[model samples]
Target: MFTNEQVDRFHKDGFLVVPHFLSQATSQRLLKISHEYLEQIDLSNHPLTRFTTSDKDHLGDEYFLNSSDNISFFFEPDAFADVDGHHKLVKPKERAINKFGHGLHLCDANFAAVTSGNADVSEIAKGLGFQRPRALQSMVLCKQPEIGGAVPPHQDSVFLYTDPLSAIGFWIPLEDATRENGCLSFAPGSHHDHPVTKRFVRRFDKETGEQLDGTEFISLENREQIEKGFAKEENQKWVSVECKAGDLVLIHGSVLHKSEVNSSNKSRFAYAFHLIEDTAVYDKLNWLQSSVKSILY
Candidate 1:
């Protein structure tokens, strides 16, 4: 079940990790599915792409949602039986790394790249200690501890299809996840207050001189306070959950969290499933869906 300390930490940090949510068998099953899925598509090159691979700048890859994994995940039978309820899997648009791409892509960048697919909800919910059955949007993150495997320090709520404020995540580690590889980090209690929104203008890279379009120029969140080194002051206030295979972390979706990079030569991988409210609406921010159909090819 959920512990008091875990709950407290979740509230403060926007995320929490349960030591054991998935059995070794379950994690293996999902990973197996991923290996098969990876065979059919062009997904390995994108560091941070919507397709696959870790390509961070392939923001256009966000719309690439044509995987058997996604369809199966959104409508899986177990999905209908959860406490918070089941959520859908939609591909997301990656945030702009440069200046020309200003419009918000309708799909969210929930790291759809790594999630293998929708989970076996009944089994997953039961494993997470939810008695009555629950559904959630979960993704499995697989990382190999090579250099540059670190995820950037962006917040999850900022990476979404909509502005929903409450979500409890189940972060499961299929292998022994350590801080040296890429684990997760969070800003405690960030959920209760006003959202920390970052603003920026896309600019050319200083060294590469590549133009960055539609990027944040500044932030309206508690800029001064967040920068004040509260992390160093409150040891407990800043916690990064690490785990072994079968271990899981339940987190508040609104928590400001980011994935650490795997800087080692060894292989490190974990799958994370994202769950949101059952009733959340995923409106398409891309209005030109019909307009550009025939013109561009």
Candidate 2:
């Protein structure tokens, strides 16, 4: 749970960290499940993507491009290998995964246990003043040792947006997260000034009933783009959020945040999911849509 002081801090800082929100046992259980999934993946048949940087290329790969109603595995940019004349997935699955997500909470029982009916997560949501909250995404971001990519500063609403910007990110580190391994960083109270700028959306044609051609980045009225938005004064305000395993970091929807690449020998792993207020209007065109229930699961 959270105290009044913590709640007040969240309102002002646009983020809050809850230490030891999960037990070591629980975190280990989730980590085991993640490893199990990774072990079962067939690298020969796996879509070996070094990194998912291609918005256009993803449209061609069925596994990466298609939005299934089930859990899927997405590989890191360095997951592939150069075999003879071509690059393919290198041996040892532990070194390949970038992240596996989108529907894990709904379909994977192991993952669901922590994301849904999670008392700590629930309490934090309530403390942050959320009403009618619903889980939207469940993912494990693997900041693999050497090749972990840098996540440029951005907002939750940019990816998982709602009309009223009522989404929050619950990031739980499964292992020690430190400055050397790229922990999350934030610009305090950045949400107060910035609004949802761009959205990854899909449009359907009325005549054919077919999903629109490709993903679209619908731009909204905002002063600056994510990469270049912050001024020197604002940039100076950025702070690193280091965490131990079981610590949970709650993030505001419009907060400016990003993580550096993991250049260290140690790997950084984190379990994350997003919750949105049910009262808000979730954009229908967002790329991640649910099948069993409304995408707001």
Worst 10 residues of 2 by lDDT: 53-62
* Number of clashes recorded per candidate: 53, 4
Give per-residue CA lDDT, model 1, range 33-95, as digits (tens): 544433433433433322222223423322333221242211111112235564422222111
User: Could you tell me the lDDT of residue 30 within candidate 2?
Assistant: 84
Model 2 error, position 99 (Å): 0.3
Model 2 residue 128 distance off true place after TM-score fit, in angstroms? 2.2
Model 2 local distance difference test score: 0.76
Ten-residue region with minimum lDDT total, candidate 1: 288-297
Q: Candidate 2 — which residues are off by over 4 angstroms? A: 49-62, 65-68, 81-83, 203-210, 221-236, 294-297
Q: lDDT tens digits, residues 97-195, model 2? A: 778777788878877778776666677777777777788888888888987777767888877888787888999999899999999999898887665
Compared with the true structure, model 1 gives a TM-score of 0.54
Best by TM-score: 2
